[model samples]
Target: MQLLLPSDVVRKMRKHMFRAQRREIGGMIMGEQIADQQFRILDFSVDATSGTRSKFVRDAEQHDLVLKEFFERTGKEYHRFNYLGEWHTHPGFSVDPSLQDIYAMQDLVDGTGGVDFAVLLISRLRWFWQYDCSASLFLRDHQPVRVNIKREDPNAKTEGEL
Candidate 1:
């Protein structure tokens, strides 16, 4: 499996991850899945803070507002970029999904509409956010199976770069 993330998404995630080094932070991931094994991360939110040093939860209303506004502003034609998954940081420990984390993914997938599948992206970053997306086995085996993160060209801006 492969997960392609935009440089802008990487930049935003790293900013929040670096700023909140002592606690955990999280948000929703928006992207599209291509073929049997490719997920392209087009956008994400990072301001939702519901966590301690070891765990994090997303702010539902904040997430909803972001998603609603993003989709509304972008128009429905570009709505292929909907809810792809969740992304959070493990402040001090490994980025591997704990049993609890895997369980939570089930709820997210059930509630999220218009998607055949979802992913959980974890970052084991200290000063930088290293995004890692996993395959479906994450929920089955209760562990994270990482995929590739392909970046955009150095000179080119990400899809929605401003």
Candidate 2:
């Protein structure tokens, strides 16, 4: 699957990551599925002060609120726009998913929550506004697969331009 990260979302994530300094921060990723096996990340919750230097546990309640708000704003469309997955900052560490990250995503998809698959995006600020990131798709009874991520062009007038 391919994940499209909009420039605005990237900027918001970078701002939160920089403000968090060495600590990790994260939240839910909400977006729309534009085509087969393609998803666009439109917005994400910013968790600025709820993590340590090496660990981040998102506030489920806060993220739920964000999701609900998105749903309301989108006219409660379930298939067109919904929860995609999660994202978190790794700060000084590599962007690769830790063992814990893998297990968490696996549990999420495999659980009775009705999610057949989920994406985990791990990222860290490299320097200035530059970032190193990895996106992995977790499926039930399957290994995590590396997902291709394309950054959306801010000036693009249409999806074809991306």
Candidate 3:
């Protein structure tokens, strides 16, 4: 499967990461599955104050509000638009999932009433407006798989943008 991240969303994430400085920050990723094997990241929540130098735990309540608003605005399309996964900054570290990160995602997908699969995006600011990121897909009872992430064309507009 392929994940498409819009430039605008990256810009917003960069700003949040930059502002957090050495600390890690993260939030929920909400988007749409545009094709059978393609997912487009439409929006995300930034929990700027939820992390420290080495760890970040998302504020689900805040993220839930964001997701609720998105669902309402999107006319509650559950099949197409829904919660995709989570993302967080690594800051002064490599953009690789820590063991804790891996376990968390695995538990999420393995839990009852949880999603069959989820994506985890680990990123760190490299320079101004530039970031190093790693994407992984976690599935229930399966090993994590690396996912290809592509940046959306700046000139192209998706339905969310319109």
Candidate with maximal lDDT: 2
* Model 2 bad stretches (over 4 Å): 156-162
Better of 2 and 3 by TM-score: 2
What's the CA RMSD of model 1 in angstroms?
Answer: 5.0
lDDT of 1 by residue, 1-162 (tens): 767776777787777887887688888877765656676777787764567888787778888887787677557535355676778877777777777877787655455434445677777564455544333323332444555666654577643211
- In model 3, which range of ten residues has the least summed lDDT? 153-162
- Which parts of model 1 have CA positions greater than 4 angstroms off? 33-37, 110-115, 126-145, 156-162
For residues 1-162, what per-residue lDDT tens digits would candidate 3 score against the true structure? Answer: 888988788888998888999999998898998999799999988899879999999877888999999899788999999988999998888888999999899999998527999999998887755777889999899999999888886786643221
Q: Rank the candidates by TM-score, best first.
A: 2, 3, 1
- What is the C-alpha local distance difference test score of each model? 0.67, 0.88, 0.87
RMSD of each: 5.0, 2.5, 3.7
Each candidate's clash count: 0, 0, 0
